[model samples]
Target: METILKIENLTKDFGRIRALNNVSFTIEKGNVYGILGPNGSGKSTTLGIILNVVNKTSGNFTWFDGKTSTHDALKKVGAIIERPNFYPYMTAQQNLELVCKIKGISKNIIDEKLEAVNLLEWKNYKFSSYSLGMKQRLAIASALLNDPEILILDEPTNGLDPQGIHEIRSIIKKIAKTGTTILLASHLLDEVEKVCSHAVIIRKGVMLYAGPVDEMSATNGIIEAKTEEISLEELAVALEKSPQISSANVDFDKVVAKLNTEVSATEINKFLISQGIVVSYFEKRLPSLEQQFLELTNNK
Candidate 1:
C-alpha cells in the first residue's frame, strides 16, 4: 500500500498544556481512517498540526512519503477543521464559484462537485435558506472544488440531527467509494464503527490503540449457547470442563462461555456432543465497537 501520510512521534504543546504527546500513526492511500476519542481528547489538535494550521511543538510528520513540500502536498488535500463560512445571501452555486476563484481552479468542475454531495439540485438555493444539513453538504462541495486526492474532516457530523447525520454519512461513503483517502476525526463511536475501516483511539492526548476496527472486538472470546437436552446449570458445568473454555456461566436460559485463543463455536459443539450432550442453540458473540471503546478509554 502507498503511504499517504506518516507521523513519527508527533507531539504538540499549547503553552503549559500538552495537547498531544508522542502520537504516531500512518495513513495509507484509498482508505478511510477514524481518529476517535471523547471530546477534548486532542483529535482536533492532531488534525490542525498535520494540516499546518497549528505548529507542532515536537516530532515530525511527512506528507506523500516526504516527496513534496507541505505547501505543494496540501494542494492535493481538502479539509474542514471548523465550521465553514459562507455568505448567507449567496446562492450555493455562487458561493462555490468564489471558492473556485480563491483556489484559482476552474469553475468547470463546480457542477460535478455539487452533484457528488447531492447538492446540485439546490445549486441556486440561497445559503441562508438551506437547512443545516444542506449547509454542511455545501461545505463538503466547497472542499472538493480542488478535486483533492485526500479529504480531512474534523467532526463532520457533529451537532446534526439523525437525518442530517445520515446525509453526511452517505456523502462520505459515496466519496470513499471513489477511492479518495479520508481522515475523519470524530468523538462518536457509532460514526466511526459504521464509516471507517480502521481507527485510532486517543484519550487526553494519549494514544491508546491503533488498528483495524474488527481487531478491537477479536481480542475477547464470548460464546452464547442454549440447550434443551440438558439443564442450563448442567450445560454451564460441562462447558467449563472443556480445555478450550476459560469460564462458563448460566445466563437466563443459556450458557455463556469465554473461550481461549483459536477456539471456535464448532469446537465447543464437538466437545458437548462428546460429553453426551446436544445444544439446541449456539452463537458467537462479537463485541460491538461501543463496548470495546468504553472498555479501553475507561481503563485509562
Candidate 2:
C-alpha cells in the first residue's frame, strides 16, 4: 500500500518538559488510524506538527511520500485539529458556502457533503440553533468541502452524549466508506476499537505500541483477583515467587499478576492455594484495551 504520512524520530520539548520523545510511525492509505493516548500524551502535539500549525522541537515528517510540493501535498488533507469558528447567525449552508469561498472551491458540493453527514435536511438551520451533534456534523462537512483525500480529526466526539457520539461515529464511518483515509486522535479506547482498523498507543509523548488494532487488542496475560485467607501483600509475594508469573502488584482490595503463559492461570491458582492462600474467586480473563492503555500509561 502507498504511504500517506511518515514520521521519523519525531521529538518536541517545551523547556524541560518533553512533549514528544522520538515518536515515529507511518500511516498508509485507506486506513482508519487512531492515535490513542490519554490527555497531555502528545496526541494533539503530533497532529499540530504534522499539520504545520505547531513547530516541532526536532525530527521531520513527509506527506504523500514527497511526490508533490508541500503546499500541494497538504492540499490533499483536511483537518479539524481544534474547535472551528462558525458564525452563529449563519445557517449551515451559509457557513459551508463561506468555507468554499475561502478555500477557492465550488459552492456546488455543499449539499452533497451535507447529505453525506446526514445534515442536508438541516442545511438551512442556523448554526446557533443546531444541536451539538448537528454542529459537529457541519464542521465535518466544512472539512470535506474540498473533498481532500485524508481527514484528520482531534477528539472528534470530545464532549457529546452517548447518542451524539454514536451519531458522529456513524457519520465518520459513512465518510470512510467513500474511500477517504482518516486519522483519529482520541482518548476513548472503545471508540478507537470500534472505528479504527489500526491504532498507535502513546504515553508521555512516547510510542508504546503501533500495529493492527486486533494485534494490540490481543491478550497481555493479565489476571485480576482477590483472596479471602491471605493478606494482599502476602498474595503478591507468593505470586512473585512463582516461576510462571513475571510481575505482581497489589491495588488495594485486589492482587493483579501478569502470567508468563496463557495457560498458567490454573498454575497461578494452584500455587497460591498451596502457599496457604485461599483462592476465593478466580477468572482467566484476557486484557482489555482499556486495561492495556492503563498499564502502559500508569506504569511508566
Candidate 3:
C-alpha cells in the first residue's frame, strides 16, 4: 500500500497542557482510517495539527511522501473540522458557488459534487430550509469541490438522528468505493467500526492501539449458553469447574463463559452434555468494537 501521510513522534502542547504525547501513525492510500478516542482525547487536536490549523510542539508529519510543499500538498486534501457554517439564506447551489469563490476553485463541478453527496435534487433548496442531514450532506459536497485525493472529517455524524447517521455513513461508504482515502476523527466507536478499515485508538493524549479493527479483539473466546433443563446458576458453576472455561457466570437468563483459547465451543457443548446439561441456546460470540474499546480504555 502507498503511504499518503506519515506522522513521526508527533507531539503537541497548549502552554503547560499536552494535547498529544509522542504519537505516531501512518495513513495508507485508499483506506478509510479512523482516529478514535473520548471527547477530550486529542483526536481533534491531532487532526488540527496535520491540517496546519494547530502547531505541533515537537516532531513532524510528512504528506505525499514529502514530494510536495505543505501548501501544494494541502490542495489535494479536503477537510471539515466541524459543522460548516454556510450562508443560511442562500440556496445550496448558491452556497456552493460561494465556497468555490472562497477556495478559488471553478464553479463548474458544483452539480457533480452535489450529486456525489446525493444532494443534487436539493440544490435549489435554501440552506435554512434543509434538515440537519441535508446540511451535513451539503458540507460534504463542498469538501468534494476540489476533487481531493483525501477527505478528513471530524465528527461527521456528531449530532444527527439515527437516520441521518445512516445517510452520512452510506455516502462515506460510496465515496470509499471510488478509491479516495478518508481520515475520520470521531468519538463514536460504532461509527468507526462500521466505516473504518483501520483504526487508531487514543486516550488521555496517549496512543493505546493502532491497527486493523479486527485485531483489537482478545484471543480468548466468549460463548453464551442457555440451558432449559438445568438452572442457569448450575450451568455457570459446572462451566467454571471445567478446564475448557477460564470463568463462567450467570448473565441475565443465560450462562456467559469465557473459554480457554486452546478449547473450542464444541468441546464446551460436549462437556455440558456429559454433565447432563441440555442447552436450549448456544452461540460463540465475537467481541464487539464497543466491548474491545471499553477494555482497552478501562485497562489504562
Candidate 4:
C-alpha cells in the first residue's frame, strides 16, 4: 500500500504539559485510519498538529510521501477539526459558494458537494434554520468544495442522535468509496470499529496500539465457557494447567478465559470434556475493538 501520511517521532509540548509524545504511525492511501483515545488523550492535539492548526513543539510529519510541500499537501486534504463557522443568515449554497471562493476553487461544484451530503434540497435554507445534524452535513459539504483526495473528520457524528449519526456515517462511507483516504479522530470505539480499517490508540499523550483493527483484536481473544457439572475452582485449575490459556477469571456462573492464538475454542471444549466436564454453554469471542482498547489503556 502507498503511504498517504507518515509521522516520525511526532511530539507536541504545551508549556509544562506534553500533548503528544513521540507518536509515530503511517496511514496508507486507501485506509479509513482512526485515531482513537479518551478525552484529553491528545487525539485532537495530534490532528491539530498534523493539520498545522496547532504547531508541534518538536519532531515532524509528512503527507503524500512528502512529494509536495506542506502547503501543497494541505490542498489535497479537507479537514474539519470542530464545528465549522458559517454565517447564520447565509443560505447553504451561499455558504458553500464562500468556501469555494476562499479556496480559489470553482463555485460550480457547490451543488455537487451539497448533493453529496444530501443537503441539495435545502441548499437555499439559512444556516440558522438548520438542525445540528443539518449544520454538520453542511460543514462536510463545505470541506468537499475542493474535491480533496483526503478527508479529516474529528468526531463527525458527535452530539447527534442515532439517526443523525447513521446519516453522517453513510455519507462518510460514500466518500470513502470514491477512493479518498480518510483520517478520523474519534473516541467512539464502536464507531471506529464499524467505520475504520486501521486504528491508532493513544492515552495520556502516548501511543498504545497501532495496527490493523482485526490484528489488534486477534492479539488477545476471549473465550467464554460454562459447565454446571464442574466447580469454579476446578475449572480455574484446569485452565491454568493448560499452556494455551493465559488467564481465567470466574465471572459469576461462567469462566471467562483469555486465550492465545495457538489455542482454539474447540481445544478448550474437548479438553474439559476429557476431564468429564460437560459444558452447558460454550462460545468463542473475538475481542472487540472496545475490549482491546480498554485493556491497552487500562486506566481503570
Candidate 5:
C-alpha cells in the first residue's frame, strides 16, 4: 500500500500541559483510518496537528503524494474539525455554494457534491430546518467540494440519532468505495469497527495501538459454548480448570471464555467431551473491535 501520511515522534504542548506525546503512525492511501479515544485523550488535538490547524511544540510529519502542510498539500485534503460553521438562515445549497466559492471550485460542482451526500432533494432547505443528520451531510458536502484526495472528519456522528448515524455511516462507506482515503476521529467504537479498515487508539496523549482493525482483534481470542445438561456453574468451573482458558464467565445459557492462545474449534470440542461433559455446541467467537478497544485502553 502507498503511504499517504506519516507522523514521526509528533508532540504538542500548551505551556506545561502536553496535548500529544511522541505520537507516530502512517496512513495508507485508499484506507479508512480511525483515530479513537475517550474524551480528553488527544484525538482532536492529533487531527488538528495533522491538518496544520494547530501548532506542534515539537516533532514533525510528512504528507505523501506531493502533499505537504502547505497550500498545495492542504488543497488535496478536506476536513471538518469540531462542529461545522454555516449560516443558519442559508439553504443547504447556499451553504455548499459558499464553501465552493471559498475553495475556488466551479459552481457546477455544488449540485454534484450535494447529490453525493444524498442531499440534492433538500438542497433548498434552510440549514436550521435540516435535522442533525442532514446538517452533517451538508458538512460532508462542503468538505467534498474540491474532490479532495483525503477526507478528515472529527466526531462525524457525534450527537446524531441512530438513524442519522446509520445514514452518515453509509455515506462514508460509499465514499471509501470510491478509493478516497478517509481519516475519522470518533469515540463511537461500533462506528469505527464498521467503517474503518485500520485504527490508531490513543490515550493520555500517547499512542497505544495502530494497525489493521482485523489484526488488532485477532490478537485476542474469544470462545462461546453451550451445553444442554450442564449447569452454567459447572461450565464455569470446568472452564476455569482448563490451562488454556484465561478468563471465563457465564451469561444466561451461554459460557463465554477468553483463551491464552488461539485453539482449534475441534480441540476445544474434544476437550469438553473428554471432561465427561456433553457438548451441545461449541464455537470460537471472533473478537470485535469493541473488545480489542477495551483490552487496549483498560490495560494497566
Candidate 6:
C-alpha cells in the first residue's frame, strides 16, 4: 500500500506546555488508522495540524503520496474536528448545499453525499429538529461532499447513545470497505478495536506504540481456567511457579495466568489434572485493546 500521510519530529506547544513532542508516524492508503490517547493527550492537536487548522511549532508533515502541503494535496482530504456546526433553521440538504458551494462542488453531488451517510430521507428536515445521531450523519455528509479519498474524524461517536454509536460505527465500516482511508481520533478503546485495522497510541504527546492491532494484542498472552471445586488461590500459586507462566492471579472462581508465549489450552488442562486439580473449563484469553491501552499509557 502507498503512504497517505507522514509526520517527522512533529512538535506543537501552547505557552509553557508541549502539546506534541517529536511525534512521528505514517498512515497508509486503504486502511483505517486509529489515533488513541487519554484526555489532553494531543490526539486532537495532531489531527488539527494535519488538517492545516493549526500550525505546528516545529517539524514537518506531508500528505497524499508524500507531497508537501498544497491545495491539490489537501483537496483530496476531508475532516470534522470537534463537534460539527450547522444552521439550525436549514434542513440537512440545505446545510450540505452550503458546503458544496464553499467547496466549489457541483450542485448535482448534494444527494450523493447525503445518501452516503444514510441521511437522504431526512435531508429535508430542519437541522434543529434532527436527533444527535442524525446530526452526526449530516456532519459526515458534509465531509464527504468532495468525495475525499482520506477522511479524518475526531471523537465521531462522542455524546451518542448506544444505538447511535452502533449506527455511526456501521456507517464508518461500510465507508472503509469502499477503499477510503480513514483516520479516527478517539479516546474510546472499544471503538478503535472494532473499526481500526492499525493503531497509534499516544501519551503526553509521545508515541507509545504503532502497529497492526492484532500484533499488539498478541504480545500479552492470557489463559483462563476453571477447576472442579478446586481453590483458585492454590491453583494460582502453583501456576506462578511454572516456568512458562509470567504472572498469575485468582479472580473469583477463575484462575487467570499470563504466559510467556502462546500455549495450547489442552496442554494447560492436562498439566492441571496431573497436578491433582480437576479442570472443568479452560481457554486462552484474547488480549483486549483496552487492556493494552491501560498497560501502555499507565506505564508511561
- Candidate 1 — worst ten consecutive residues by lDDT sum? 213-222
* Higher-lDDT candidate of 2 and 6: 6
Q: How close is every model to the real structure, measured as TM-score?
A: 0.82, 0.77, 0.88, 0.88, 0.89, 0.91
CA lDDT scores, all candidates in order: 0.86, 0.83, 0.87, 0.85, 0.84, 0.84
The 10-residue segment of model 5 with minimum total lDDT is 65-74
Weakest 10 consecutive residues of candidate 6 by summed lDDT: 64-73
Cα misplacement distance, residue 163 of candidate 4 (Å): 1.3
Pairs that collide, model 6: none
lDDT of 6 at 240: 78
Cα lDDT tens digits, model 6, 76-145, are 7888877878999999888888877777778788888888778888888999998888888888888888
Candidate 1 lDDT tens digits, 28-116: 99888999988998999999988888999999999998999887788788888757669999999999888787767899999999988
Error of 5 at 188 (Å): 1.3
> By TM-score, is 4 or 6 better?
6
- Residue by residue across 142-260, what tens digits does model 5's lDDT show? 88888887999999988888898888889888888898999999988898888899999999899998989888754447777888887877887887778888888885678888888
Given candidate 1, what's the lDDT at residue 41? 89
On a 0 to 100 scale, what is the lDDT of residue 33 in model 4?
87
Model 3 Cα lDDT, one tens digit per residue, 8-94: 888988999988999999999988898989998999999988888798999889999999877677878888877867899999999
Highest lDDT model number: 3
Q: Give per-model CA RMSD.
A: 3.6, 4.0, 2.5, 2.8, 2.4, 2.2
After superposition, candidate 6 runs with Cα above 4 Å error: 66-72, 217-220, 250-255
Question: Which candidate has the highest TM-score of all?
Answer: 6
